[model samples]
Target: MSSSFQANLDEDYIPQNILLTGGAGFIGSHVAILLAKKYPHYNIVVYDKLDYCSCLDNLDEISRLKNFKFVKGDISSPDLVSYVMAEEHIDTIMHFAAQTHVDNSFGNSFNFTQSNIMGTHVLLEAAKCHRGMRRFIHVSTDEVYGEGETFETEAMNEEHVLEPTNPYAATKAGAEFLVKSYHRSFKLPCVITRGNNVYGPHQFPEKLIPKFTNQLLRGRPVTLHGDGSNTRNFLYVEDVARAFEVILHKAKPGMILNIGGANEVSNLEVAKKLITILGKEDQMDELISFVPDRKFNDLRYTINSGKLHQLGWKEEMSWEEGLKTTVEWFTKYSGRFGNIEDALVAHPRIGFAPGSSVSNEH
Candidate 1:
C-alpha cells in the first residue's frame, strides 16, 4: 500500500487503511469515532500533536477498538508523517491538523502558517511519495470565503472565490492552494471541504458556543465582540461528522465541497438563545458584556452546501436541540479541560510576535 493508487478505483473505491491527522480534536474525534464504529474493517490511525485544545480523552470511545490506533507526532515533520503513512499502510488521509482559533491567529500568526500551511505541505509531500495514497481530504473553514449577508443565497456552489481577511483564514486558504497544486500536478486525488462553525460536546470551550456555555454555567458574564451583529452558520458536530462520512464515501479527487448549516444565527442571537435556555433572562443585563471587535471580523460566512447535500448529506440536528444538549453536557462535565479560566476570558490570546505583549482584545 506504500505505492501509487490502483488504476481502476473509480467504480469501487473502499478505504482499507486511513490516517486522520489531528484526529483527537473536536470535529476530527467525532469523525474518528463514526468511521471506526461504522466501518469496523477499516484501520483508523489518529495522528495528533496533542495541542492544548486537543485532548486524547476525546477519543476514549474508540481507543480500545481493534481498528483504531493512536500515534503522537507533528504534521510539520516530514519524516514522522512519512513513517506513519508507511507503517500504517495508509491509503486515504483526512488532513485536519491546523491552528484553528481565529483569535489566536492574530497573536500567533506564525504558528498558524507553520501548522496550517507548512504542515499541509509535509502531508501532501508524504502522500506524493507514497503512491498507494488514494484520497487526500483537506479540511478547511468557511471563513476563507469572507463575509456573506444573512439573507444572501449560498447557492453559488463551488465557484465562489476565496477572500480570507484574517490571519487564520489566510493560512487556511494558503493550504488549499497547496492541495490544489498537488492535485493538478500529481493527480493526488485531493478533496477539499470548507465548513461553517461547528459546536457540540467535548469542544475546547474557546469558541463562542462552548465558551459562553462554560461562563454562564459558572455564573459569569459572557463577553461579545462589537455590537454582536456578526452572523455565522453553525452545524452540530455530529452533523458535521456525517458530512465527512459522506465525503469520504462519495467525493472524487480534485473536488471541493462546502459544509454549512441552515441555522444562520447572529452572535447576539446565539447569546440570547443561550441565556434563555439557561434560565438567565433576569441576569441578561449583568451576564452579557461587549468587547472590542477583531481587527477584521467577517460579518458572515454562508456557503452553498448543495453539492454535499446532493451526496445525500443533510443536517439532522435542530439548532435548539444541539445548543441545549451542548449546554447540558458542559454542566454535567464542568471544567472538562481543567483551569480554563483564561480560555473563558474576554480575549485570552496573546501576541507571540517579537516585542508584543498582548494581542487585540477583540
Candidate 2:
C-alpha cells in the first residue's frame, strides 16, 4: 500500500467513539479488550443488555480504562439504541449483540428472532440516521452457510449460498440481509464478518472446549454426539477479535469477510485431545459417553478466508497453544460457573445447559 492510499484509508476509517454492542459476551468482550488496549485515544462504549450469558466479569480487565464505559441497554430497543448513539457521539458501531446458541434457538426461536433479527434492524435503522456514523461492522457466524458438503477440494467463500439449517443461523442470515439492504437503500457504511468456531478464555462454559474442560475437571464423562465425526474449524478468540479490527479499518462498505481457522478437526478428535491434555488418556474408556446426535446437526463446516488473509490479517495463536490456554483458564476459574444451588441463576438456559446447569453459554 502506498502512502497516499494509506492516508485515504485512514481518513475514511478513523473512529472517534465506537459503540461495541454485546461487549460483555464471549467474542464481544475479547474484541472490546483488544480495542481498548490497542487504541487509547478512541473512546470505547460497551453497550450490553446483561442477559444471563453476558457477564460483567468478562470486562474486568478493561474496567478501569478511562476511555471505557459500560452502558446497559438492549439493542432491540430503538429508543435506547438511538439515545446511546446520540449521547455517546458514536461514530463507529461494532454490532455483536445477539442470541447465538443453536440448540436454544430450536426451543425458543422467538428470543433469537427478537434479539438477532429485530435487534439488527433497529441498529441498522439507527446507523443510517446517525449523522456522524462512519461505519457499521456487523458480526456474524459461519453457521449461516449451513454445512460444508465436501472438505476435499475448495472451502466455502464469501459468495457461498446462505442456507442456514437452524433457527439461530436463520436469524443471522436475516440480519445480514437487513444490513445489505440498508447499505443498498440508504448507502449506510456497513461491513459484515462471519467467523468460524472461536475458543479462548472468558468463553461461556457451555461451549465445546470450556464445557468439556469443565467436565474433565469434575471427573465427569465427555458427551459425544452420535459417532462424533462432525468436523469444525476452530479459531482462537483473539484472532477473531483482531480480524474485526482489520475489517473495521481496511474494509470498504458492502464488503463481507469470512474469518476462519486453518486447523480443522473432528469433534471426537477434540474430545480425545482434551483427555490427553488433562493427562487422563488412561481414562478415555471410562470418561467417554456416546449420546444421541443433535437434531439437524451439520456434518462439517469449512470456509475459505483468502479475502481476510489477503487484507493482511494472520492468526497469531496456533490450535495447540489456544486450546492449552483455554483448558488452563477453565481449570483455574471453575467458579465462574457458580455453585449447584445457584446454577439456574448463573446461567439461564432455554432448553438445557450442555453439560452442567450453570452454562456461560453463548
lDDT of each: 0.83, 0.80
Q: Which regions of candidate 2 are displaced past 4 Å? A: 1-12, 339-362
TM-score of 1: 0.93
Give the poorly placed runs of model 1, Cα more than 4 Å off: 1-12, 149-156, 351-362
How does each model score on TM-score? 0.93, 0.92
**Candidate 1 lDDT score at position 199:** 93
Across residues 78-105, which tens digit of lDDT does each residue of candidate 2 receive? 8999999999999999988888767667
Question: Which pairs, if any, clash in model 1?
Answer: 3-131, 3-132, 4-131, 4-132
- The TM-score of predicted model 2 comes to 0.92
Q: Per-residue CA lDDT of candidate 1, range 1-362, in tens?
A: 01112223345458999999888888888899999999999999999888777778889989999999999888988899899899899999998878887887887788878888899999999999996999999998887877775456554456687788999899889999999899988989999988889999878887899999988888888899999999888899999989999889887776788898899888999998999999989988888889998777887877788777777789999999999999998998775677787678787558423211110111
What total of clashing residue pairs does each candidate reach? 4, 0
